[model samples]
Target: MKRKYSPYTLPPWLRKVRGACAQFIIPICVFQGIRTILFPFTLDVLLLTLLILLAVALHLNVI
Candidate 1:
């Protein structure tokens, strides 16, 4: 018989970091998106947040 691993499991430390990034950064990105939609001023913040989101997503294999 062969053992199998569940793909949902992650290392404890990594899980914490990934959870935090998702919880914190995702909301911020959403708000930034709204800000850009409402008032088209200073897109730098929106761009930065999107970049961060992309980086975090790549790191977590969410994309």
Candidate 2:
């Protein structure tokens, strides 16, 4: 069976890094989204989709 995930088991420094990433993810996603809207390039769209998925995963604490 797969083990349950626990942030508490992570190293202190890693936890801090995760916290920092969680804080910045939203604004980054927003900028990527606006950029995608303006450019609509294949790469930009793919990046935006990845960013959105990452943001959702972070918000849901699934990462």
Candidate 3:
């Protein structure tokens, strides 16, 4: 016999909020990368490299 698994499902509201949070975080990082690239004097090169790595990891779903 097969058993149904119900615990994996999330309510609509929770799903919406999670999606919103992801949307918010991704753009901010992207903007930071762009800003860093445009104005390299203000922030350290290592910080910019880390931000770019973060963006790549996000795209690759490593984070």
Candidate 4:
């Protein structure tokens, strides 16, 4: 059987880093989305997609 995941199991510094990333991720996603919309460059699109995936993973605590 697989063990359950717990944020408390993480080191203090890693938890802090995760907290900071969670706080900042949304705004960064929004900005990347806007930039992707305005520019539509291939690189920008790829970056935005990666950021969105990261945000979803973070939200789901799958990181």
Candidate 5:
């Protein structure tokens, strides 16, 4: 029986990557979501939205 640190759920090596991702993801996602809604519509905005969706995939642990 043992307790583990949150980032230690992964293999010894991946803990760093996972921890880094968790640190930046939520704030970045929120910024993208807001930027998409506030600005004029354009292809660049569309690409940004798509990129934000990619962030959601990472946020959900699919990446």
Candidate 6:
């Protein structure tokens, strides 16, 4: 009694794009945070803030 479709089926292209973003978006954000934080003593305040923000995004699976 299965119908022809349900929410589980997404078109292939759309699904692929989401999969790709899920692969590297979080790491890139973290890398940028580290580069800013570690390279310059002047940006310590901004760096810590951005890093924490990225961490929260990572934990929440939103980034």
TM-score of each: 0.45, 0.92, 0.39, 0.90, 0.47, 0.42
User: Whose lDDT is higher: candidate 5's or candidate 6's?
Assistant: 5
Clashes in candidate 2: how many? Answer: 0
- For candidate 6, write residues 1-63 as lDDT tens digits: 865633237688966765665566677667766776677565665766776676666455554
When 1 and 6 are scored with TM-score, the better candidate is 1
Query: What is candidate 6's TM-score against the reference?
Result: 0.42
lDDT of candidate 2 at residue 27, scale 0 to 100: 98
Superposition TM-score, candidate 3 onto the true structure: 0.39
Residue 58 in model 4: lDDT: 90
Each model's lDDT comes to: 0.67, 0.89, 0.63, 0.93, 0.69, 0.63
Which residue pairs in candidate 3 collide? none
Off by over 4 Å in 6: 1-9, 39-63
C-alpha root-mean-square deviation, each candidate: 6.3, 0.8, 6.7, 1.0, 6.4, 7.7
- Candidate 2, residues 2-31, lDDT tens digits: the string is 998888899999989888988998999899
Residue 40 lDDT (model 6): 56
Ranking by TM-score: 2, 4, 5, 1, 6, 3
Cα lDDT tens digits for candidate 3, 1-63: 975544237688965765565566667777777777888765556666666676665455444
Best by TM-score: 2
RMSD of 6: 7.7
Q: After superposition, how far is residue 42 of candidate 5 from its true place, in Å?
A: 3.9
Q: Which lDDT value does model 2 have at 23?
A: 92
* The 10-residue segment with the lowest total lDDT in model 5: 1-10
Pitting candidate 3 against candidate 5, the one with the higher TM-score is 5
